[model samples]
Target: MKKKIYNILSVCLFALLVSACYDDEGNYDYHEISTINTEGLEKSYTKTSYQDVLHLEPTVTATGGESDFEYLWTLNLTKGSGTTSNKIEIILDTIGTDRVLDFPVNIKQGFYDLTFRVTNKSNKLETYQVMSLSVVTKFSEGFYLLKDMGNSTDVDLHASDNSLVDNIFLKMDGEHMPDAPVSLGLDPGYCFVDETTAEYVITKALTVCTEKDVRISNIEDMSTIYTHSNMFLGGEAPEEKPYYVWRNAYGVGYISDKGAYFSTQASLWDLLGTGKFGFPAMVNDDEETKPNRNGVFASTCFYYLDELKGRFLFLDYNGSLHTYSDLDENNEEKPNKPNGITHHLKFFGKNYMDKKSTGYALFEDENTAGKHYIYQLVLGMDPFNPIEKVTEVATSSKLNGANLFAVNELTAKVMYFVNDNQLYMYDLVQNTEELLRPTDMATGEEITYISNRYWSGSDNADKNFDYLVFATRKDGKYKVYLYEILGGKPYGKPVRVLEGEGKVVKMHYVDPSMSMVSYSYFPNSF
Candidate 1:
């Protein structure tokens, strides 16, 4: 009986082993597998900025499996391109459950074609699917400006045209560079030091590229000196000089570390003191000697007024603007300040105006009247009569915080700060005030102050003009928004024209003739 029991137990063990084997084997009716599901073999991929990697996701399914199944994947580009076999593979029993396949490896940037195939235990083969994808190369070109504190450098390039031009560099010569460089009305053309030496200088080019024959002293002197700052023809004779007497032609306006300030008429190379205005009144102080009497009023803003001659403006930091008139009449040696020069104003705030100028000025009532006013100034007017104090258009309680105001010199339309986020426009001719609330513009729910710098295209050269540009912070980044000046005011939804990671430090329309724009960017950090 014991022997019989042992034999029975052995038989039972064999049966159990066979049962386990059956369970492990995939169960599918081969006869029923007449159709294979290639739909399960769908594959897709995504491309990234990374140059080398290729990512793939593939899904596979089969109608029936009589035995173990296997999958083979291959990648191919165009014809004649080599093929990668089994770049990815799976055994239906063990790894087949995974529908997504990830292939992480470096691949060239180009078009690629891929295919996947599968085979079952019966040796029946099937082409799963074919896919095509593209890998693009990444490259972009444009202009950029770099600023370090008061020192600023700009690089402009015509990438598509393959033309490289307009590179400007302004380095503060003193302790630190100011935020703005006022236009001293110095000519950026040929600067003459004395009647004999002539130096060709372009503002954009001088900032970066070095000229073969030019000397720094030559440029510096031309930039600072007025009388000798102009170019004389080959046959022109030098005027008899007590050279000192010639200096009276050009007046020195303001000087900063970026460069000396002289009338714009002075050639690019004239020396500073040689001009008519001489150097700005020198300040007498113990802490630090004021370089020029202009005194270091404020360092990071600019203001400009466009007049009949051209555009007259001053950089807040430099206290001067680029002037062509200074170049025509004034000789290099006798640099003369641009005529009709007026007082400079500086506004302070984080998003405060980076620059100011144009038909108006910000003034505070002295009577403790708690009223701030915008005054239209006559360009190049006698400083004493700088402002006829036109009309009391807009009033602001926070005069100290107001950084900028703009006037449509053509329309005589004034836009000023009623509050941080609220802007009001007064038509000088209409004598009507209109409120421009942030909520009205689809710039998000929160109302924020629009940028102080405002621009209207020449289309508005006529009273019915309609396009405008201004800076505003939205979605966490500062962007220049383009708005249509409908009916003489900022109206309608604003479209983003330019965007950058950094804040726009300053923006100047490249005059009305050209569609180009000159803007400065200050990085987030200092």
Candidate 2:
């Protein structure tokens, strides 16, 4: 009986080995996947905006296939000049059997070919499905505003097309932000990080809000936000929150309470580790409450205020941080660095010129009389070298403080400044100052914020005339005044007084396509 059992076991082992060796043939026990089919495959899609989320979650049906299979959905966008095209790949991981797939359809306005490939594990055969997608502009004409509403901040949408939805953020998410009831700090700004991505920074505990193709589409989903608690190199704690956030080719940077920090992306927490650098804030010994955390300048090189040192400093991409004078002093050819005027600046006007010939407006120095000097900083042919041009523009009386609203790049000559009760236009070309308009400060009527419509044509009635929008408040209502600029001066009284809601504190003209204005308001007056 033992001998008979041994003979049977040996025969079975030999059969198993033969089957394993012949598994590559069609004789395998597992069912082979011959073909794959998907039902309701969308052949074409009409995308109006980058925010349009395409419902990719489609039922994938397969026939004549084994139980173990893999599904791959791929999308390729082709862009370039003529025959030379660059392919942007979008791939979803492999999955088993029939499943639903979901993804955003946020891409630049263009035509793309999408492909779906499925493979059977048993046979290693692939079945491909092809489709086409068409993306066009829908809400491309509008301006989006991030505003402070006393208790919290909210995003408002002003659309040129009446069909587009208004107050998009509240409508889409039913909340001000993903983190509701979060207040914002000074001067929140937005920048296009890439062809499809836009980053919005409100500076509440270092939260960066990201949006994809926000312009021409209704936000069908919730926004993704990133917050950084500690952002320091060598694992050190963050010293201060950013006051102003700006972006360029180098990356995003912030003028923080502690100084200046630059990051490759919105998540500042990992900035230092991911090839980022920072400049320390000027040390405060006398203990001043409010440092001039106003404006910032950035291009290939960055220039920012050093409050404690009471001067301006620039950081180059080569990781070199020095003052304009430091560059001169280092050069042996120029021995004594010019030191006649004090190197002090309270704020910088919004830079609106080309990087090669960029011009910046600087508030010269703070004084007891509250009288401040206005200086136009012009970059020479060599961007690293700069020349300071002092403007005779002076404030009427001792104006305590003012906000640099907008810079006119059309003529590269004028800028708008908003104080408590007046709006001043400083002509850099002629070095002249003019108070364009005034408000009654007694009845809570004061100019709170201003924004420039630097866009051309679009919805603007006069293509030649640029606009300066002023946010003035009285009682409980907010009024917006759009002043047309003829030549380089405010034409007259505001051409239009727009109806504004809430306590308008901040405003920005976001998009040129819609000629829409975005402004932030507070529930209560400041």
Candidate 3:
């Protein structure tokens, strides 16, 4: 009886299906939507200057309802949104509505995601191609001017393109600096392979310092990474004022209260304090260990002359401090030397081209107090040996009142000095001097700063000696002048003159090496 009921139900279902097939009155049709195949779009576009046009012309192919289509080009910034690798797009601008783009890239210099979209108006179908774009500017590199505005200090950029960005700290940080600017430290990490551990290392960054505050800013984007309290490993800077801050191939170094401190090749990334600095560079200033007004740095160490002891001291790359002996065992001038003591030696960053422990040193006579002498220095490769050369320059009329000095890196023999309003070039080879003064002094203007710094990070080899840089102040107004060096001397007048609102304390050429990336400590991260 169950088998008979099951057969009856199956027959009823089959009859219903047959009846439905015969009663069908519907039509099925197929349509082809527009398709777009875009070509000539590179995977990425990078490193274009700000003044150039975005000349992008791509070959686009379409089919089906291609005749009726609309085009749109949009730029968006893709940002990571959570812990995952997923990204969220923030549309920056709708650049164009045409198939070809001849638009000027007027956006800020940075990385952006570009999207080209094409839609078939008839079918409402859309197709897109995305690309990565990187924008840069010529204005990113050039001279940096530290301007002293009476009560405060700030930075300005005289860009490579001859454009000036005034008050860069305020423009980028959205406010004034924590304190007045003190000095600029640029370390373009010169990567080296450590022989002992067979490890490669590069710790690079730019340090902008003030009297009481230190700010570490990223050179890549000119962004503030760590400032003031966060920059110090101790959480707070030393109560004593910092006289100098500098970065070189080895590490970041600074001088505070006559003592120099170094942070070995440590970076801001990976962890804190690795790039942070601590401890006063080794100094036994019996009389308060008073270091000189300024000091110089080697590739592996920073050097200073103690005003109290009148000896040379060095802080190595490992954060260890040492003093190179400048005396004989007898405590008297060595037979091979005269006035062998470094008591009156003052440093002016003279080791612009030394790959070892050698360069020029300036000496002052204790007898003729205000006078100075230029000497050759080779403190020896090791601490045990003292082999050096000193230039015993007599106190002459030309050398008198020579307060400012700038060594010419090209010749290594030309020294530019200023006396009152007069500028003189002293040739060390011939021991002769030439007066470079304008000779038409109306109001007395005093010269303030002069330097011939070596730009090790620059591809231009002669960057150090190519210009004669100096500053002058009179009646509260300041002028920073740069003269092109021809032969071994500057032009009759400055090729470029930058007027400052207050005193122009220092000027430096910002080079490519100063910019440090997020250099990974892990070898695999490279």
Candidate 4:
């Protein structure tokens, strides 16, 4: 009986060993799983004003008829002129019945044909559908203005490449309101609150005020008038406050909304006031009180003096011209004065206290009286004063309130005001002015002084008029006009570029190279 039991035990042990060996044999070492079956593979292309990263779908199947599997995916850029080596390899450690691999590719603007291949443990071969993605980069070349729709206080930028003009009404928190709106000045890149927290955030990302009716003030009232009613108020008005103006240089920088800065003559009261009132205010002054009292007084309008230097010149209300460089250190404590280098050019009219005084002086060079009745001072040196000279190029009658822009370093141009409906191009070298009429300037009855400022472009180096963009009032509405500047002359007639449903406030050329135009509009206050 003992022998029989031992035999049974030995047989049982042998059988168990055999079973283990069989199991080991069943486990196959696969160099490559069969071709992986790729699912959720798709490709598409699009164009946007900004650069964007795209994500592809999660890869699904890597079937190779095996219980356990591994996956390796390779992206092959078969066709493209750019760096064709744009490829990625994804090694999937987890592969099962329900497991799916994910692959992502960053596609830029262009055409591309992409192929995705996957390998699995069983060496099974499967290919995802070849995706032909043609991403056409779409961009609008014209200028854009971003603004807050609710309180009309938050101004920002919106650019378009095409010619279609649309009114961009700011809505609080990304809500669009066509009725209640604030028009922007011009395209000045993005907009944001001049605060530490918001820093350089785009204007659209800001929180909109739930209530409106903040007092709105013009550029002039910010300094002398300390009352709230004198200011343009948006957002919620404080309850029965002491009528104190915020005094916080809130909306006082370059009007990115209008593509310009405030240039107003500083009043004597403002010069002695407690707050910094102008664009290039006094640099050294008490922060708690007012700062910087030696610069141009407010009474100027902002002008893009030079693109290369990125400096803006403005005329102070004191009849002086000041240049403010965007590349300046900004201090929140004393917010009025720009912390960068500030140049001042006082343009005391031939005689103060004479409203009709025609002549002016370049205070920076010499305070001497000059014979030329300087109606306007375009900052930067001209033939008269070659090195950093401020040229008195236009008279009030010729340019009127028409915005002055630098056609080039040596020459300044202005859209002529009144019925002549022409552009006055002044040659600093020749000391001459040329009249460029795309057509008859719209009649005075059609537009107002505050209508959209004239717009044009000049390639000073080439001595060629690049393009001319302007706006006119028609049927109590503002319309945009585009004219190509060819061979130092305008061609054909002005083509209607954009027509909007609101009152046009300002228009600007995006660049001197293109025919694009950016315009701003506000609703009619009927």
Candidate 5:
């Protein structure tokens, strides 16, 4: 018992001695914490674009503990209140790690918060600044407004959102747009082959023509795929720019001072085309028939004479200097009448009422140059002479002095034309002229251009609506009016009147759905 008590007391004494040695009243010293500051950062940035360089150089300052610092810059997409997954932040990327951030803005268009953080390495103290950043792309979707400004061209884009992106040619090409506009043609899609790799991609292609040049480009970004000389299979451009360029599902071809060149033949084995236009189609590749040049610039171009698919008959009214050729789907010529007397025709289009083989061309007799005779063709499957019968159009003074003609593509049910500042619609079936406006003539107000296009709305895959549009110039200013067609006459109120710069040469609506590789794919050689 005595030994146990001694052992326990000894253990307690050793524990107490150790605790007393460790416990001490000591004077402690404290060091100051490090701090960081960013003073030169802007509160927000606006008008930024894709492929733009986002320059961020904030003045940073750090004090106390070693003064060593680390930098970071991060981008996060700014989502709105009702956006999906409200709790999660979309961290786009860590754009930078240095004090000065010279980041190339490669992210798609969106509102974002750009953050810069500086950390004091010695004390682990951090400071950050967030700036509002917005990225925009004008090329996303829009109507390319090709305007004639006399000395130079202004290819502006009226965005689908109603925002105007002016002078897109200068903004994109870094050069002034060329002037003396020849033609601006649009195909559903074009396949461009890489000049070096021989690889190809189908894209939204647009043909632009000036007095000096003819070029094809991807309409989405206005990026050039082929220039003048490179557009032909011979590797030589036309000495004269094409006065008119035309394309359809059947072929892509152009008429220049030289002659006609076709880029595609629907019957050819290579439906994709050779990526360049070939020489004019020939009869057994022997005799060449250039388009009949009736007037300067071939004022009266060719038309599909019958309900036939690919046979274009260039009208020759004055003489038999030109002969009609029956081109098969292979674009090869066929025997005419088995007698060799090719028919010569002068075709005036009521080229409206589309979607079917409704061939409506007003045949111009040799004597009646200014008269209108509407002819709707009903013919055999192999129409040797498509014109079975003709309807003599009743004469009217309203048609007098009427110069411009616009056939509505709603299948030409009604055509719109202006006479002496007055707008009129001629019913092809009724064989009558109805004046849409009376006392419409006012001094200093003149109608400039008129046409029709198939348009439904933005992002519209099915172009269902047909609108008859016309432009008027008053007091040195121009405005275009759009009217929807219901039952052949312009229905209801004017859909919209667009005011633009200079003279509106053409308006091409950009469909976002056209950007896909296979969407509306056609054999447009480039």
Candidate 6:
């Protein structure tokens, strides 16, 4: 009887093993998908900007396949002479027979062909479909001015065609910004997008609104591109204060009460945090982490000030952020770098002279023995290792209380800074300062803001007719003055006078060659 029981147990164990093998075999079926078809599919789409998502949902039908199958959707962007593959892939999790594929597409203005691949238990099949997408914006070629009109802010566009459109935001969308406009960040019209095209953008701040508090618009028609209306308004205002905004080569990067945040040209106000939207943080885990992206301003020559870290950061071409100390380890100048902890860092946006150069300048604050000395950083060296060049240019306590600073290639190595209504010229080469008092203008009207071709194209490559535009306020009115600098001084009386512009708080000149030379101002109270 015991031998009989052993024989039965052995037979039962063998049967169990065979059953497991059969189930495993079933996982690999010999099914094949046949006659896959897509219905009600659109072959072409119109996309306004990179932020606009093109929704494509097509009904799919397949026959002669397993009851359920996996789906994959892919879009291959055409690069080079339409030979290279710029692929974006998405996989569907759920298995299905007859289904609809929901795909959202965001890419630069170009053409792309999409494909869908289906996989069954044992067989794989792919279907190819070609489609065309067109993207165009009115802000592509123009000079844009974002104005604050107490109740609501508006935008003005001076198109390349010499046509001026006033309050274009309202004309395009029938809406104004959230509140009174505080600050505006405009690209100096650099073609960071491609060799032939540039996407001009405008970033502005509002007074009263919180959610969707910041607005970024396209310069083509002053149409709204992206708004940080709901998502980012909860954090502390990043501008350190309202009416102040920070910008880089292509996007608006500012320190919010929350943290450092930035958005790109293609993606207006996504408000990407560090390492989130491919933004190269000054410090990251690895240098080879992210890909070089074309979303920001100048990939090679953009610098930003991190007030929280008390350090100046440079964004390299390959989506990496580095400081002067982080550039080269063996450099002798690395040791003399300022201790961000011991000394305070005061950064002036757009204060440096050359916007297109590899280096910029700033004031290093030192506190000792109840006396303070302001050191001017005339960084003329490259960020990466090469030859040892001059970095720190000048230092003086007399250059304090400077509210406005600007640099340009036309002025050669000279820099201009405004302190308490007095305009002082600091020669970065000679290491000297000259105070020039205006002869005829408004008394007690100190220079509130100053702008020039510093932020113009190619670091002042087109400096032949470059002029310095300054703003002053007196008797509740704002006046803009333009002076041509010859022999390192204001050559003549204000060549251009734009009087009666109410409360001219900020000013910038688009390269005259790029757009018709026009300036727009906002009223004190609208």
Which one is best on TM-score? Answer: 3
Candidate 4 structure quality by residue, lDDT tens digits, 1-526: 9999999999999999998888444756666544445556566443331344444545545444543443333333333222121222222222122234332334323334544444344444444445554432222224433222233333222234444434332222343432332222222111222334532211111111112222221111111122223222342223321111111111222222112222221111121111212332321221111111111111122222222232334333232334443222331232222222133332221111212211222222123222232223322212121122335543443433333222321112222223244455544334555666666445452332222222333333432333454555555455555565443344677644555443343333232122101111111010
Candidate 5 lDDT over 319-435, as tens digits, reads: 112223244445555432211223333434434233333345443444656555555542113324344245665665455446555655444566566777677887766767787
lDDT of 6 by residue, 268-373 (tens): 2222221112222446643321211101123223444444554555554333456555345455554334224244334332222344332334444455332322
The TM-score measured for candidate 4 stands at 0.38
lDDT of 4 at 278: 33
Candidate with maximal lDDT: 3
Report clashes for each candidate as comma-separated counts: 79, 4, 3, 68, 5, 14
Which runs in model 3 stand beyond 4 Å of their true positions? 1-55, 60-139, 169-182, 189-206, 219-224, 266-274, 283-290, 325-342, 351-358, 384-387, 437-445, 453-465, 474-476, 512-526
What TM-score quantifies how close candidate 1 is to the native fold? 0.36
A best-first ranking of the candidates according to their TM-score comes to: 3, 5, 2, 6, 4, 1
Using all chains and alpha carbons, the TM-scores for the candidates as numbered come to 0.36, 0.55, 0.64, 0.38, 0.58, 0.50
Measured over all alpha carbons after superposition, the RMSD of each candidate to the real structure, in angstroms, is: 24.3, 15.0, 12.5, 16.8, 12.9, 17.5
| Candidate 5 runs further than 4 Å off | 1-137, 170-179, 196-198, 257-259, 265-274, 292-355, 362-369, 378-383, 391-397, 438-444, 456-464, 515-526
* Model 1, C-alpha of 406: deviation from truth (Å): 2.2
Score residue 419 of candidate 4 by CA lDDT: 28
**Predicted candidate 1 versus true structure: per-residue lDDT over 1-526, tens digit per residue:** 9999999999999999998888455866556543445554334443432444544444445556443556665665432111111221222322222234455434533335556665664657554666664443221122222212223323222222333333222222323222332211111122223435442222211111111111112222112222222322232323311101101122223333222333332221232222222332211211111121121111232323322222233332232333323333223322323334332323211221325323444434545344454544333322222333444434433433444444433333545444455556655445566666532344442222233333333343432223444555554444455566555466666633454332333332221111111122211000
C-alpha local distance difference test of each model: 0.34, 0.45, 0.59, 0.31, 0.55, 0.44
What TM-score does prediction 5 earn? 0.58
lDDT of 3 by residue, 1-526 (tens): 9999999999999999999889656776766656877788898775544467786888776776256668999886433211011122244699999988976876555456888998878778788999877665543467777766655667777776677777777787676665566677655442223336654433234566677776665444566656657656767666776666665324566776557766665332321134566666554433245556566655455666666666666666565666654455555454333223544755454433333434456677777776766656553335532435556665575765677766666435677787775788777667788887432222367777776533443434654335677788887777777776665666566666776555676776654323332111100000
